[model samples]
Target: MPKPLFGMAVAFGLLLVILLTAMGSFALFDRLDPPPLDKLSDLSVEVIDRDGALLRAYTNKAGQWRLGIDLDQIDPEFIEILLTYEDKRFSSHGGIDARAILRASWQLLSNGRIISGASTISMQLARLLEPRQKRTFKAKFWQMLRALQLEARMSKREILTAYLTLAPYGGNLEGIRAASLAYFAKEPKELSLGEAALLVALPQSPEARRPDIAPRRALAARNKVLERMATAGIMPQSEVMRATSKPLAAVRHAMPQLAAHASDRLTRENPGALVLETNLDRALQEKMEAVLRDASSKLAADLSVALILADGKSGEILAEVGSPDYLSVARAGWIDMTRRQRSPGSALKPFIYGLAFEEGLIREQTRITDSPVDFGGYQPKNFDMGYQGDVTIRDALLMSLNVPAVALLDAVGPARLMERLKRANVSVTMPEGSDVGLAIGLGGLGITLRDLTQLYTGFVNGGYVKTLRDSPAEASALAQATSNMGAPILDRDAIWHITNILKDAAPPQGAAKMAIAYKTGTSYGYRDAWSVGFDGRYVIGVWVGKADNSAVPGITGRSAAAPILYDAFARSGLTLAPFAKPPLGVQEQDFADLPPTLKQFKLAGLWASPSPVPEEAPRISYPPDGARIELSRTALGRQMPLIVKLQNGRPPFRWLGNGRVFAANGRRRSISWTPDGQGQSTLTVIDAAGRADSVSVFLQMPPSAP
Candidate 1:
């Protein structure tokens, strides 16, 4: 080897040794760690609707309104502008910039004050990740070291993203997203040239240039960024001039408060989660919320309203408005009325009529008396205080005759209707400890708007009960909402008949009624007015009343709730679908073509033929003889009450279970019994003629398999 080459090699060895020693000596760095990249991006828990639109957002534990943001979510122009204004070579540098540092040092020394910053975007990110109040050389050195470490562990994009994620904007705002929305009332992707420049300016001196507090300063600072962009040639000088012509936001707007009740409920349901996506349609929710809010001004001061829209097919809740105003203390708008239990008046009549159709006990043309009737001292009168002596079941339902409903309920037995509702997964609170009676057919019971709307889905669907859900992707919640415990509530023919009757009922004044089938209900004493409507696609339920249950005079269901219901269907963009075509075995006929048994429904009691068929012996039909019945048993070994229904049975009858007489009533066809244990037992029923029928059965717990 040449002597000069050997000398050069020796010099390189000494420099390498000095570099190693310097690195080792600086190894004892500050204990402060970098901000967790995952945590910074996972800032707040947000409730999003079905369309992935934001409904509500909750602040982090530190009470900071830091929303998560993505690099791609921001406009490319803004990204470029941000890069040029902050660090022109951000993508190329590791963490620190040596040339920029030397330039800043000379400027500081020459000017005797800080004129320019030496920190690259990455170094600034390190300072943000572990913020410190001190402005000392040691603190800056530590931050620069952390920046190098960040460059080693993260990609260039990751480094930039961390800065974007944790960058301070103004007030409590941090990151590009928070600034964009606070100053511009839009997402970062929608920022214009001036808006982008303004956002870029705020982070440098957030409080000093905040538009809300310092508009003139904000404008001046924003123009400075525009000038920088012009200097960098990233944005044209002409565009910067035009951008300066743009106005700055004079005030900070509140974050979106849509779906307030749903967000509150869901956040509580899923605590500690960073995101709580729901199934609400953001557009529809906002539209309906506006509808209710607008209606509030026309309504009484203390009155509030709640409404919900659900998809009939999949049963997802598309929109929910819990109250007219969330902050109205007078209206008690903070209460989530959709989940509140309130009486449903005439709205339940459709189900009552459906049960009669399901049983083949009545036809549409069947004549029913709507005159004043006293059922064991309980008298049912119409809202008009007059009676239509005899009307078809079809007209009776349309006009909402209270007497006809109670009289028919007397025929069907209100208890049976309650059973059907419970079977269809509807919850009803019968005046505590009180048995369901004829009065229950006219809003004597209580049910939540959520459950009642779900129940009304029976008419929209073909008799099968499908559970309502917020988000189908949420399996655990879906499981609870849809336990599949519901059995068939009515046949397809039965549901069709009910929808057919109500679909043509008159809509509210000035509102053109579509092919939607809906029912209006007013709770007794005018405390609640409700209307639930359904096309083949959507089911909407609306309630108008005081949150305190104060009676509002003349607030009938048709007069109050029906208007909102009809207006909602007209305004909501959802396509209304036609009801299902009459299914097979559905007999649509005039009075002459109907069967003799269904031609004239006896409103008084059970059907008693003028002439008897002697050979048809009275017998038990349900829970057939010697059949094993798996009762829904509790963990403590108690069983749900099971009813034994009879066939061809006379009115005056006696029922026995386990050799103990439980029911000895006048002409009742079915009786309920609770068993002591799961084993073989005899169920016997005897008619007035002493004709007895018995069935032996074994009761066991239902299978626990999912």
Candidate 2:
């Protein structure tokens, strides 16, 4: 009774089975035949140089290798290990492994989700070459089909070679060959079994297998690769055991002959130039690195350092260290601190003095009172808690006096100074106060190594400000907005004068003083130490501080950072040349007779003064022989006939005040003082030689009883 019905049901079931099979085939074919992708190894790297040497490379995009050697020189063991771990049958099979596919499919069906990957070496290469595509089953199938197609088109060895040379290992290292040289500092052909194992483990997870950094994890992965190689009969079992058991050899690191800074420039010029010629002086770079490491050790382990050495005239960065460990392969290590910004201590004073000289607030010979200057509630103390009633701007700069710089900042206008800094590409954030900007004037602002170095260029380059460029081409390409105002901040004569003072004021003995003009900077609480200077040839800057953003106890720029600069110059074997002649308008003065105010106040030997000698008081005015500073009183104090006087070391001196003049001998001079109780004061002076000098000190006194 149901034979016909049973037959119809059977036919229907068979038709359903046929339909399902056709659908499955369509899915498989779709997955295995996806569209081809464009090449993915797109990168542009920057390389920097000094004279004509290869320094280092930095990539603006991915797939850039910064190794100092050729890829072909890499060790063969690394390739073996990579193939053994990433694709065991790389030499025996096509790109797609049927066994692997079956196993993965079974696992996925049982788990109800894709739980494992069956990607062959070719497939992996395809993924790397076209990483922009989606990662779905369809995408994976297409990758497999493409890999198989590639296998048909190319030999197994050819595919493997491409994979080994094109894969990204880690930070800027794009191939196993480059990675081998970078991690071990040796040719790839020279890698040991243990070293090969480590490199092999990296392709699975570059960060995870960073033997130079995470040795324990790298060792474990390397052991696994060795075990696999042994199991596959690629190596003898005894050899595998020995390789797995032996301690990983310490990899030799490349002593990059190029300055790390040069890398930034090279990457911008050529996108795929793996081997770059740089301008770094290898000797100078090594010395700089040594000094930075040593200086940081004196502080906390977390302390960091950054530096840049440039040609003063050419603005070429001879050496640059962005951090203590620029090549650190660790997952967690010291960050590049040089490019980052932090507070600058006394290093910024030169710019202040330069501006003061330009404004005519104080001449090099004018008397500057080194007293405890009170700016509203803010009081600036000296390095030594002392004061000299009288000091010239040149002497103040030589000693790095805080009061005078603050005084000059108040007079020249902090806003103007900030404008100057901004023009130099340094972004400075001012603080709060009637003298808010004064604090920053003494380097209470945050600045980066690049910007700080550029700031000093003004003094070296005829007082004109400019921006920093990775190369001359980049500089020339800058838009008007990016370029600085080329106007002179200080007269060329003024800059020349200040440079001479700085040269004389250099620490009695230091590393860079032999061939450079420099200034040191220390942050509050000694958190950061910086030294920046220039000679006729180059400009250099260095900074040392804590990596964890904590203070480096007692490490001042003069103490810790300047030595690095000195060491670099010494190692580079560069000559220190005399700065060029200053443009005219710089006059000379004799620092002799003491002013009556200094004598009356008994400021000599006072602890609050920037005394010429530790125990002696400072004598001179705003600008010393070659220094410059702005001079103005804090507030409009009672109007008084302020006396201005100048005396040579030899003889007669004359005091000038209120348009009148008086005479004096070599020792000391006194002038009449008349107070009108107003807030303005002016003084004039003429030495026996008839050299005229004038100064105005604004004094704002406490209000009388209301």
Per-candidate alpha-carbon RMSD to the true structure: 17.8, 16.9
lDDT for 661 (candidate 1): 79
lDDT of 2 by residue, 368-476 (tens): 7777655654578765443555778777888787887887777777888877776665565544433445688766767788878877877777876556554554455
Clashes of each: 2, 63
Worst lDDT 10-window in candidate 2:
629-638
TM, every model:
0.79, 0.52
Name the runs in model 1 displaced over 4 angstroms.
Answer: 1-26, 30-42, 472-486, 585-587, 605-706
Model 2 quality (TM-score): 0.52
Which 10-residue span in candidate 1 carries the lowest summed lDDT?
A: 632-641
Candidate 1 to truth, TM: 0.79
- The whole-model C-alpha lDDT of candidate 1 against the native structure comes to 0.77
Could you say which candidate leads in lDDT? 1
